[model samples]
Target: MSNLVRSELLKIRTTSTWWWLAIGAFLSIAMAFPLNAWLFNTAVEGNAEDVGLTGDAASAPAQAANLYTSGQYLGLMFVMLIGILMVTNEFFHQTATTTFLATPRRTAVIVSKLIAASLLGFVFWLVTTVIDLGAGAIFLTLNDHGTLLGEWEVQRALLLNLMAYAIWTVLGVGIGTLITNQLGAVITASVLYLIGTQVVSVLFFMLSSWLDSLAVLKWQVLWPAVASQVMITPGENEMLPAWWVGVLVLIGYALVSGIIGVLLTRRRDIS
Candidate 1:
């Protein structure tokens, strides 16, 4: 298992795609700095009418938390693409044959890929978090907005954002595995994570409007992103499940996708 995991890491490290993905994710984080700085400055100058600065939005902690979380979220798509490519690229280049030949037990190979993808996700999360936080703090300081690095609320938000990124990456891996075609997998993940959630939310809204009794379904977990929003943003949505329940829902999505992918791969003929 250890050897298999090492081989997967080596495969990733040897590829130009990994570096590009990492660099892209970092660049996304870097780009968020200016946007956040502008937003912070605008709010500071009492131009919070356009932005979502409602009651207490002028508070330092609130501003800091928003800056950090928003910046980290910006990089989420890139990391997920990395995860999708990690698996789909194998099939794209016809390397899965060699990989499976080296490890006859397809389950072991799948597990190794999961482990490698998880590690890659964590590394991506770390890079994005550090860059976003450092840049955000600098911008805030320069604008005289003050820093909330020491605030417990800001600290907790930072941790949750990192965890959310990591979880999303793993989910991407499962999605990539299930959809072996590179383009297909990427499209599916994008639609499911990005568009699918909004569609579901809208549908639920319509259903509840037509039938108030159906409102109960609104609280039921449907999408991983929705569950994650519930977990990270407390008290904002009364219809969302509890934080722990949201965590479980996310885990369920990742695990079920992995299991299905493994089963399909075990029966698939590489040649």
Candidate 2:
């Protein structure tokens, strides 16, 4: 058992893409800085009088932080792909047989890889959040607004954001395990994220609405959309199942993928 874990951990630590993910996370925060500042200073505060708005000025800092974090979230999609490639690439390379031969335990390997991926995901998430939140505070302070980083809602959002990113990382690892081929896993995740999750679903939903002449059954085509919305908003609108439901769905996807991958690996001939 220890050997299996050791081997899996070694593989994860050595994977080149892991470092790239960290770098990308930092880069995402760096790029988002200016945009966050612009939005906080110009739109939220500047446009207030013209738009006849009246809200707490502190909300601008919070909103700026959210926008900054959003950029990091997008970059995490690539990190997920990186994880998938590392986890699934082993099979296509025929290295799993070597790994199993060394450890002779299947489940231990999956557990180790899952743990490592989750840990890496968590570190990236936290670092990105701090970068986004800290930079946002600085930007807001520079504009004559004092720091507002310790708000309850911001902390909650950061926690939820970390969990969301961790779930996606685990899901990506499972997809990698299930597919085996690195390229297949990457293509599948990319499609599910870029096309299936957002563009295709929204377009399909819109088309459905148009065909029904504004009387369409909206709930029928809301899986991906609801899933995304729930993850971001959690219990805000009760629009879909709570964020916990999405978390469960993520776990289910990862578990099923890992199980199937393990079964296949165990049964296949190793020549």
Candidate 3:
């Protein structure tokens, strides 16, 4: 298993895909942090009612969480693409046949890909987190909102952010497994992640309004993107489920994707 994982990592390191995705993730974080910090500062000063923050929402922990998790929206998408590329690249390069022939046990190969993809995801999280911490600390101090590292809410947000990175990558692997066509998988995943979430949210909002019940809004957490956002939220939200619910939702998606991917790969005709 170790050797298989190492081989998978080597494959990733040898390619340009990983670095391109990493660069995208880094840029997303860099561009997002300052904008988020500015908006947060604006809200903190009581001038931005449209920012949707009030009382507890404007607390140090909440601001810190938001700052620390900045760029998650696009970062996760890039990470997921990396996962999709991991499997798709195999098929794209005509290496699937060789890979399976060498390994024989397809499950081990898939698991190794999952492990490697996950490590790559962690690297993304680590890089983004370091930037967040440094920028967040300075921003917080400038705004008189202590670094708040001692706060559990801040800590939980960071931890959950890391989990989000890992799980999304695994989910990507599952996506790649299902869609072997590299271009199709990448386009589908990118569109669904970047646009589908907004479309789904709008539909849900319309449904809730028609039904005259805000309860319908809670179901938004079922979507992976929303679930990711929900899990890292620093405090209670009336419109969303508990933070753990989001974690569970994402985990369920990853598990289902993995199981289906494994089952399909076992019988797939690589040739």
Candidate 4:
């Protein structure tokens, strides 16, 4: 275990990409807090979300939670790219073979990378949460929407958001394993999250009620909004899964990817 962890840390330390990814996550959350507060101050207060949804419609805490979290991750795009690179570089850079020859426990390598990435994700998530929340609070005070802070919902959101990002790092590792090429994995993930998925989701929102079987969280809408909406609202129905539902769906993909990556690393001629 120590050997595998040492190998993973060495690999990450030798690269500049990891630092940049962490920085990107930091900046995204930092900017998002102030921006969200301004948007809510201007837009939500101006009939933005329709009655019963904003201003006096719902709990101020809920509205504040939604505003701070909605776009809290503009940097996550780059963060995912860096994560893909970390896993796939072994295949591209001709190191996986040598490492396996020395260690022989192939699965250990993947697990080590998964653990490292998860910790890295957690650190960034904590920093991002602090700054983002602080900024929201300061801006809210300036704008005269101050509160004395609420109860467990904020704590729940912070914890869940960290778990979500950590899971995403695992998912990115899986993508790197399956593709075995950093650029391909990053681009494919980006397309799914940034473009293709969102487009389909918007269309679903327009047609959900009419479709009879369609719900806002159908495949189209569900994952696309998962990153933004997971902690922003409480579960609506007892039948509905918790906020981590979509994230759990994502973990299945990560497990598959990681297992296949171990197999490929063991068998493939990693030149």
lDDT of 4 at 214: 44
Task: Please identify model 2 stretches exceeding 4 Å from their true place.
Answer: 1-3, 46-65, 68-70, 207-229, 238-245
Residues 50-152 of candidate 1: C-alpha lDDT, one tens digit per residue: 7866555555675677677654554666777877887898899999888888889998988888888788778877877777777777777876766778887
Candidate 2 lDDT over 174-245, as tens digits, reads 778677677777887777776666665566568766775433333322343234334444232212345555
What TM-score, over all chains together, does every model reach?
0.85, 0.77, 0.97, 0.81
Top-down TM-score ranking = 3, 1, 4, 2
Question: How many clashing residue pairs, candidate 3?
Answer: 0
TM-score between candidate 4 and the true structure: 0.81
lDDT of 2: 0.62
User: Over the stretch 1-271, how does candidate 4's per-residue lDDT look in tens digits?
Assistant: 8767777777888888778777776666656665656556655456555443543224555556655453345554654565678777877787777877887777887788788777766766777766667776777677787742564555566666676667667667777877877667778888876786567666766676566554444444146335335433555442234555656565665677778877876676655
Candidates sorted on lDDT, descending: 3, 1, 4, 2
Q: Model 3, range 32-57, lDDT digits (tens) per residue?
A: 99988987777777756677776666
**lDDT score, residue 146, model 2?**
63
- CA displacement after TM-score superposition, residue 214 of candidate 2 (Å): 9.6
- List where candidate 4 sits over 4 angstroms from the true fold: 42-58, 67-71, 144-148, 203-210, 213-217, 221-228, 237-242
Candidate 1 backbone collisions, by pair? none
By lDDT, the better pick of 2 and 3 is 3
